[model samples]
Target: MGWIKNAKAATLGEDARKAWDAGSPVFTPILNMPSSNAGLSGRVEDWEHMMAAVLAIGWRLHTWAVCSDSRGRPQAQPLFVRP
Candidate 1:
């Protein structure tokens, strides 16, 4: 199950606008993959939805790499930038 496939553009746009207004680089929710599949699909889906919205509004993906969470757990944290 994925939300992106049925996500409303207007809703996504609103989220994007909020992030843009915040004036900080947007980061996707931490993604813990093969090590743990729990919520992986949903996280990926949300990431795709957010990416689509951001790109549509002139934001670009500036970084896509692994990062450690607060607990030092490995995960993917994609950073988006505007410009």
Candidate 2:
């Protein structure tokens, strides 16, 4: 995501306001000099690393269902019982 911003900045060049006005422009990944991350090693690749670690240590993810009551109030109910 940061790389995309840098790419847009390089393309827009010196006019940050124009880039901001562009409003989350779509960027294609390319081997550009500005966004190039060279000589980097041992970088964490997966975004779910922490989640995986938590689950490994006996944590479980639960699913919940949210519904509206008769008075238009929100209520949540767990969909399953976790052991």
Candidate 3:
């Protein structure tokens, strides 16, 4: 089971890299929450779902954002890391 999780994480990293290179969305299913849910309960439910998905995968997430600097140079800023 541990090995299986490792393999899945490896595949996920490869797929994420490909999507990043192609400028495509990598986490489509998990990210596509309905915008109509604008209540506290709805938000909590959504958070629970996302947390479950992340924990089940057994992989930490490092978030990155693409932005431009003062000189208009494109750069990636890493934020909100979990280990």
Q: Which stretches of candidate 2 lie over 4 Å from their true place?
A: 1-61
Model 1 Cα lDDT, one tens digit per residue, 1-83? 44534464456566768878788666343444433344344454444555576678777778789766666655676666778
User: In candidate 2, what are the lDDT values of residues 1-83, reduced to their tens digit?
Assistant: 65655444444332323433454232111112221323333332221232233234333445545455555544333222123
* Predicted structure 1: lDDT: 0.60
TM-score of each: 0.46, 0.24, 0.32
Q: Which number leads on TM-score?
A: 1
Superposed Cα deviation of residue 69, candidate 3 (Å): 44
TM-score of 3: 0.32
Candidate 3 Cα deviation (angstroms), residue 35: 31
| Candidate 3 local lDDT, residue 49 | 45
**Clashing pairs in model 1, backbone N/Cα/C closer than 3 A:** none
Decide which is better by lDDT, 2 or 3.
Answer: 3
> Superposing all C-alpha atoms, what RMSD in Å does each candidate have to the true structure?
5.4, 19.8, 12.1
Q: List residue ranges in candidate 1 displaced over 4 A.
A: 2-5, 8-13, 25-47, 67-75
Which tens-of-lDDT digit does each residue in 1-83 have in candidate 3?
44544554455455444545565433322232223433223243433344344434433445645465555544334332233
**Cα TM-score of candidate 1:** 0.46
Off by over 4 Å in 3: 29-83
